[model samples]
Target chain A: MNIEEMTSMERVLATLCHEEPDRVPFFLLLTTQGADVFNVSIKEYFSKPEMVAEAQIKMQQKYGHDCYYPFYYASLELEAWGSESVFYPDAPPNAGRPVIKEFEDILSLETPDVFESPGLQKVLKTTEIMKKHSGEDIPIISVVMSPFSLASMQMGFENYLDLIYDDLDRFKELMRINESFCVQWANAQIEAGATAICYFDPVSSSTIIPPELYRKTGFRVAKRTISNINGPTATHMASGRCLPIVDDIAETGTAVICTSVLEDLSEIKTACKGKLSVLGNLNGIEMRHWSPQQTEDKVKEAISKAAEGGGYILSDNHGEIPYTVPQEVLTDISRSVKKWGQYQG
Target chain B: MEFEDTLLSLNRVAAKNIISSEFTGDNAFEVINEIISPTLERIGELWAHGEIALSQEYMASRICEELVETILPADAPSRKNMPVIGITTLRDEHMLGKRILSSFLKANGFNLFDYGDMGPESIVQKVKDDGIEVLMVSTLMLNLAHEVKKLRSSFDNEKIDTKIIVGGAPFLFDRNLWKEVGADSMAVDATESVEKIHEVLGDAR
Candidate 1:
C-alpha cells in the first residue's frame, strides 16, 4: 500500500497502529513559547494568514511533530462574551474579566456569536490558514473550552463556584450560554476545516468541582458539543479527579481523550475502552526539566503503558516547557517511538 | 460554658470543611479567634483531636494569603509606633503561611520586611539589615522546619538579639519542634500569632 496516497486519517491510523508511516507525524499546538521558538508573536502568527502557515510548516520541520494545532488554547472565545484577557510573553492568555461580578449577571449574558465576534473571528481566520496549508497531509486539530469552564470565564473562576451555591438557576443559564458558545465555536472551526475538535475543560476537573457536579453540568454539555461536531472530537479535563467521569466522557461521542499530570493512563484507557482514542498522561513538567535520557524514559514508560492497541498518541498532558525541554529530547522520544512502538499483541 | 461552646463551634467548622468540603469564609476570623485559638489554649487539643489534618491545616494557613488579596486597604496604615517584622519561608517551599502572616502584620500597622520564600541565610541578612524587631519564619513541610533552628542559632552566633517567632502547620503540631528550633516562641493561628508578637514587642519596649 502506498502511504503517500493514503489520507491524513490513514497516515494517523498507521502511526496509531505502530506501523511504519510515510513518516512519523508529530503534533504542535502553536503555544506562545512554540510561536516564539519559531520567531513569531501571537499577534503576528494570528494576524497574517501566511505567517501562521509559515510557522506551522517551520514548527513541523523544526520538531517533526505528527499533529499540529494552529493556535494554543480555546479561551479566546471567552473574549466574545465581553470577558477580558491578560496576555503574557510565554503563557496562554489568561482571562482577566470576572464573568460573574454578581449572581444576577449570569441571567443577562447572551450566547456568544463566533462568526461575528472579533475574538472568535481571529480564531476562525487562524483555522482558515491552517486548512489552506494542511494539504490533506495531516490533521489540524482545534480546541474548544468546556461549558463549565467558559461559564467560569464569564462569571470569573472564584465567583462562579460561590454563585453555584447561592443561585443555581442563574448558574444553569450561564452554562447554557457557555454551551451555545462551545457549539458556535466548534461549528465555526469545522467550517474553517478543523479535522478534529479538542475540548479542554480545566475547571471541570475534580480539584475545582466535585464529581457529581461535573457529571451533572459540565459532562452533559461536553458530550452534546462533541456529538454535534462533524469530525473526530476529543475532550481533555486536566485533573485526575475527572477520572471517575471518564466513562461518562466516552459516552459523549469523543474520538479521543487527553488528560494532564494527574491521571492513571491504564484507567483512562479502560474507562474509554473501545469507544475513543487515549492520547497522553506523560508528565510534561518532567520532560521540560529532566535530562534527555530521563525525558526519553518518561516517553518510553508512557508508550509502554498506553500503546497496547493502536489508539494512543505520544504527547504531553499539559503546558509545554518554556525553554527547558531540549529539542534533542523530543527527537529521542520520536526515535524511540520508531524503535519501540510495535504492537506485539 | 462559653469556652466549651467556642471549641464546639470551631470543631464543627473544621469538621464541615474536612467532611463535607463546605468552606464558609463568613466570620472566619471569629471562628479562628474565638474558637480555634481558645481550643489551642487547651494544652494540645488541636493535634490531639485532629481538628487540623496535616494537609488541610497547612492549606488553611495558605488560604490566609488569599484573604490578603481580597482585603487590601485603600491607603497604607500609619507607620508611627509600628513594629518592624521580617518574614520568610524555607528554601524552595511554596507554602504561603509566612506570606499570609506578613500581609496581616502589615495590615495591622506593622512595618514588614518580607524576604518571601528564602533560606536561613537570607532570612538572617534581612533581619540584620532591615533592623527587623521580630524575625518570623514559617514552614509547612517537616523537612524545611529545621531552618527555624538554623535561623535562631545563626542569630545567636552573631550575638544579634532578634525576637524569633515561628508559626505554621509543622511548628504548631510538632510539640518538640519548638524547643529543637530554639526559637523564642510559637503561635498556632494568626490571631494568637499577632498576640504573641504584641507580647514580644511589649517586652522589647
Candidate 2:
C-alpha cells in the first residue's frame, strides 16, 4: 500500500515484515524534545503521562511517522527500588547513593510484579492512556530497560562493577532478580495493549562491560527478556564498544536493531541482512540541531547507503531527542526519507 | 620481597618492601617511573585485551596508588609553598586515572586536595571553598561537553581564577576540545600533567 492508503500501524507492520509500504518509516525517540510539543514546563511533562502522550501524539500527527513511544524516564525504576535520584530538566533521573546498602538487602530482594508496583503501574497507566489517545493506529512501543541496566540503578553503577568481583555468587542472585523484573515489566506492558516492546540495554555496550562478561553474567537474562516477549521487539544498543557484539545481541531474537552512528551502517546491514530490520545511524546526536536542508542531506546519505532494500527504518538512535533541536528540523528527516527512501516495488 | 619477584607474581608485598626501604629523593621518582609505570601499563594492556575485568583493574590501580603513597618522602608536602591544586574525576568517570594523576602532582611537590569522585557542581564548589589554584578534571567518556561547559561557566560567575586542566580519553577525542571547553591546558598522561601545570602556571606568573 502507498503512504496515503496505509495507516501508521499498517505502514510499520509492513516495514517490520520486510515489505516496502510506499515510503520509509520514521520512528524517532522523543526525549526532551517533547518539551516543545507541549511548551509546558519539564515538571508537568514528567508528572503527567497525559502530557507526555499528548506531546508524542502531536509529533506523530505532525510528522506522520510510523511509530509512537510513550515516554519513560530511566529513574522511575530506581524510585521503585527505594533509591533517591535527582532529575534534571531534560535528562533521566540520576542514581544517588545505592539502594542496596548491605548484602542482606539484596538477599531480601524480590521482583515486584509490574501490575502491582507503583512506579511501573504509573508507566503502564500512561501507556494505556496513550494507546487510547492514538486509537491504536501506530506501533506504540513499551520501552523495557534491560535487567543489567536496572541492576546498576539499585547499587549505583560503580558499586555494581565492584560487586561482580567482590561477591560473584551474590551478584548472580541480583542478576536473577533484575531479569525477572525485566520480563515481568515487558510482558505487563504487552498485556496493557502496547503493540511492541522496545528493549533497550544502554549499559550492555561492550565499552562498559566486556562482551564475555556481559554474555556470561547477564546476556542470558537479556535473551530471556527478548525471547519471552509476546510480540514484535526492537533493541537500541548504545556505545562504540557495543558494535563488536551487536550480532550477539541480534541473536537474542530481536526483530529490529537500532544502531548509533558510531558503527558502519553498511556493516550492520551486512550483519543482520534478512534476520533483523535496521533503524538509526542518522548522526542524530549532532544532526537534530541542523537546518532542515542539512537534515534532509544527512537522511539522503543514510538512505543511499543503508536503504537499498526494505527492512530499514529511519531513526536518530539516541534515547531522547534533545529539547534544543527544533521539531521542524526533526520532521524534516521523515520528509526527506519519504522523498529518498521510496521503493520501486 | 624483591622487586623482580613482585613484578613476576603481581605481589604488592614484595613491591612495597622495595618502595619502603631503598627509595629516597630523586631515586624514588626514577624507580616508580621505571617499575610501577611498566607494571601498570602491562595491566592496562590486559584490560584493553579484555583479559581482566573493570573490578580487577580497579584493584590493580589501587595497589599502584597505595605504593606511590607509601613511598612519598616524609618532608614532601611540608617543603612546598606551592600552588594548591584540587583534582577530581567527573562523576562516573573512572578513578584509576585520577589516582595516577594526583600521585604525579604529589610527586612533583604540589599540595593537592584530592576530591575523589565529584560531579561538575561539587568540584566547582570545592574549587571556591578550598581556594584552589589549578583544577584538574578527568573524564573517560567522549561526551563531557555539559560538565566542562558548566564548570567553566561556574568558575566565571563566581569570579574564581582557577586554571582548568583536563585529561582522560575524552579530552584526547578532539585535540582542540579541551580549550574549547575552557581548559587552560590539557595533558595526555600523568607525567605530562605535572610538567604542563608548571609551564602554564609559570607562564601566568
Candidate 3:
C-alpha cells in the first residue's frame, strides 16, 4: 500500500509495532517552530493552548509528518520547581537560573502538582486541544524529562555534579522527588490524550555520563519511571549520543529510542533490532543550511539505513526543530520521505 | 595524596592537600602544566572515550578550578601582558565547557577576560570596548554556535582586529563549522584552546 492510503496514526502505530507500514513514518518535531507557523511570539504561543493546537495542526497539514508533538519547551518542566523560563525573540526559551542555589535547598524541594503549575498546565491543555482536533488521525507525542536530566536544570549542571560527589544521598533524594513529579506529569499528559511519552533524558547520554554511571543512576530512575508511565514511551537523549549505552536504554523498557547524529543509523538499528524501534539521526544543526537537494539526500540516506523491516521513524536527531530552519527545508524533507520512504513486500 | 587519582575520584580534600603541599609559589605554573593540565586532559580523553562519566570530568574540573585559583589568582602579577583575550558562551547557558576552558587558560598563566554568558550583540560590543585581540567562544547548542557568524560580522563591520576561536559540542560535531563561521581556529578541548590561542596570536604574545 502507498503511504497516502494510511492515516498518520495508523502509520506511526504500524512502525511502533515493528511492522511495515505503507511507508516509513516521520516526525518533524516542530516544537518552537510551531509558534512561527502560528504567527505568534513563542511566549504567546506557549501560553495559548488554542494557538499551539492550531499551529501544530497547520504544521502537520503543511509538512504532512506522521506525529503531533504537543510540547512547549524543556524548561517548562523545570517551572514546576519554581524555575522561570527566559523567552527569546529568535530562539527557544531557556531556563533562567538554577532554582536550587544551595545543596541544602534540595532537602526542602517538593514534588509539584502538575495540574497546578502554570507552564505544565499549558502543555497539558495544548495536548488536550490537539487530541480533540486530531486525536483519531494523528499520533500525539507528548514529552516528559527524566528525573536525572531534570536534576541538572534544578541545580546548575556543575552544581548537580558537585552534589553527586559531595552528598550522594541528597542527590538520590533529589532524584526521588524529580521521579515522582515526572510520573505524575507523564500520566497527566496520558490522561490529557497523549498516545506516547517521549522521555527526554540528555543527562543519561554518553555525551554527558558514562554507561556505568547511567546504569547506576539514570537507568534505575528511567526503569522505575517508565514502568509507571501508563503509556508507551520513547527514550530520547536530545542529540546526545546513546550508542555507548544503547543496551541500558533498551533495558529501560521504552518502546522506541531516538538515536543521535553522532552515531551511525545502521549500527543503532542493528543494535536495537527486535528490542526497540529507532527514530532519527538527521543533523538538525546543519539542516538549516542544507539545500533542498541536500535535505533530500539526507532523508534518503537515513531511510536507506534504518527504515528497512519497519521499525523506524525518520526525524531530526535533536527532538526539537530549530526555528532557524527554512520552510523549504522542511518541505523538502516531507517530499523526500514520501518519495523514498516506501517499503517493499 | 595522589593528586591525579584524587582528581579523578572527585576527592576534593585529597586534591586540596596535594595542591597545598606541592604547589609552592615558584612551582605554580609548573605544577599546573605538568600535573593538573595533563590530568584533566586525560579525564577529558576518558570522557570522550566513555571510560569515565561526565560527572567525573566536571567535578575534577571544578576541584582543579578551586585549587588553581588559590595558587594562581586571575590578578596574579605573573599574568600575561601582550594580547588582550576574552572568552564567553554566546547565547548559551551551558557553561561547563567555558568554565573548563577558562580555568585551563588561567592555569597556563594566560590572563583572559571571562565574559560569562552573553548574547552576540553584547559580546561584540564588549570585544570592541575591551580591544580584545583574541576571542574564544564556547557554545553547547547549534543555534547559538551560528551566533559566531554574527559576532564575526560585527567585528568586521567595526573593523576590530580580534581573531575569533570557537570550541564546544557543535564545533566538535561539525569539523568545518569554525571556518564556516569565520573563526580563526577551532579547539577540540580546553587543552587545545591554549595552543590555538598562541597559534592565532603568533608573535603578538
Candidate 4:
C-alpha cells in the first residue's frame, strides 16, 4: 500500500517518533456519537458493554482517525469508591450527592479493588471487546480521567476544589486515595488490551486552577498514575488554561498532550519539541458554527503551525466533535488535513 | 466582625476564620452584599486574567456559598407576594454557575427554588405547578441547546406564561443562542441575572 494509506497505528507510532508519516494523524476524543452510528438510543448504547464496544468500532471504521479514543465516562474510579452519581443518555455522568459530605469522610474511604469493582470491570470488558474487533494495526486509546477530575466528580466539581482550598491536608489525602485508584484502573485497561491510555485531566488545567497549585496537588497526583503506567500514555487537558502549563505537563512523561482549541500552536510547537505529540487544539466550539470553508481553513492553519516537525496530530479540541458539526464539516476537516498535512521528505 | 474580614479570610481559604465573626443571620445578608459581593467579582476577574486556577476560583465560589449559607435567613419576610422564580441547569450538570445565579436572585428578594440538575420535564412541570414567574436555565455544554429548545416548546404547548432566562458559557459565547433556543432573556453574570430577573418579573426599577 502507498504511504498515503498507512494504518492508524503506524501513523501514530510514526508521529510519536517525530517522523514524517504519510499524512498528519487525526485524533478524536470521541464518545456520545457512538449511539448515532449504531442507530441505537443513547440509553441503550451507554448501558450495554457490547453495544458500547460496537458503537466505538463502527465509529473507528467510519472516522478512520489515527487514534481511536473510545471512552464512556460514568465516573468510573470514583463510582467504585461509593460516589453517588447519575448518567443520562444525552451527557456525561455527575455526582448524585457529594461522596465526602464532610471533610472527615476522606479519612475513612479506602480505594476499591480493581478486580472487584463494577466500574473497573466495565472498563476492562469494553477494552477487551474493542481489542477483539480492532485489528492488530489499530491503536485503541483507553480513556481514563485523571485523579483530580474523578475527585471532582466524587464530590461536586466546585466542592472538590473548595475542599482543596479549605483543607489542603484532606485534599492531599483525597488525591492519594484517588491516584491509587487511577493507577490500578489505568494498568487494568492496559492489561485488557489497550494500546495507549488517554487520560482526561481538565481539573488541573489553567482554566480551572493556577499552574502552581495544580502542580502541587492535581498535577502531582495525576502524574503519579501516568508515571507508573507501562507505556504510550496520552494526557488531555481540555481548557484553554492548559496553555500555561504545557511544559510542566510535558515534563510528566506523557507521550502526547492533547490540548484544547485555545492553545497557541507556535508556543506549543516550540515547547513540545521532540518530548511529546501535540494533538487537538481545534476550536471545537467556534467550528460548530463555522462554514465548511472556515472549518477547512482551521484544519489547514492547525496543520501548518503544529505539523511541521512531525510530533503533531490534527483533532477536535476537547470532548466529542461539537454537537452542531455536520458530517460534511467533519469531512472538510479530514479533507483539509490530507491536502495540507503532507510530508515533503 | 465586619463582612469584608470574614470574606477576606475565606479568600485566603481560611475556612474557620470566616465563621469566627459570629454575625446573626440578618447581619449576614448585609455583609454578603457589601463585603462578599465585590470580593467575588475580584475573584472572577482573577480567574479571567489567569492569575488563579479555575479550581481555585471554584474554591472561592464554594467558600462564598458556605459563608453566605450561615447568614441566609430561614425566613426572610417574603416580599409578601414576591414573584417566585426557579433555577436549574437544563438536562445535565454544571452546579456552580447556577448556584451563583440562585444566590444572587435570592439576595435580590425574589422567591427562589433551585431545582439543581434536572431534565426538561421536571423543570417545565415545576414552573407550571409552582407558578414560577421566571424559569432560569443555565447550561455549559453546547449540545444542551436542544434541552432549552425542548423546554420552550413545552411552555408554548402548555400555554405557560413564565418568563425563561438562559445563561452560561454557550449563551455568553453566542449571544443570539439564547434567543434561538427560545429563552425570553439572557444574563452574563449573577449581577446581570438579578437585573434580568427584575425585568422578566415586571419589577424593574
Best by TM-score: 3
Instruction: List clashing residue pairs in candidate 4.
Output: A206-A241, A207-A241, A208-B53, A208-B54, A208-B55, A209-B53, A209-B54, A209-B55, A210-B53
Candidate 3 local lDDT, B1-205, one digit each (tens): 3677898766789888887888778777777878887877777777666567666777677778788888988777666563677999986888878877776676566767899888778887888788788999999877788889999898889888899999988787678889888899999877677678889888634
What docking tier does model 4 reach? acceptable
Clashing pairs in 1: A25-A66, A26-A65, A26-A66, A26-A67, A27-A66, A27-A67, A99-A154, A99-A155, A99-A156, A100-A155
- Residue-level lDDT tens digits of model 2 in A78-164: 666776556556544455567787766889998776666576776777788778876757788878778877776676555666676
Candidate 2: tens digits of C-alpha lDDT, residues B1-205: 2453364344778767776676665565566666766555565556455454444445555566667666655355543566788887767434556765665565444578988778777787788889888888876543453477788888899898898889875554346668777888998656466667777687532
Judging by TM-score, tell me the better candidate of 1 and 2. Answer: 2
* Candidates, DockQ: 0.07, 0.22, 0.51, 0.40
Off by over 4 Å in 3: A1-4, B1-6, B11-25, B45-53, B67-76, B81-84, B119-132, B141-143, B146-150, B153-160, B174-182, B203-205
Best candidate per DockQ, number? Answer: 3
Judge candidate 1 at residue A66 and give its lDDT: 69
Sort by DockQ, top down from the best: 3, 4, 2, 1
Tens digits of per-residue lDDT, candidate 3, A138-165, equal 9999999899898888887877766766
Best by lDDT: 3
**Residue-level lDDT for A194 in candidate 3:** 97
Give TM-score values for chain A, per-prediction: 0.88, 0.91, 0.98, 0.92
Q: Model 4's DockQ?
A: 0.40
- The 10-residue segment of model 3 chain A with minimum total lDDT is A157-166
> What is the iRMS for every candidate structure?
10.8, 5.1, 2.0, 3.0
Q: Candidate 1: TM of chain A? A: 0.88
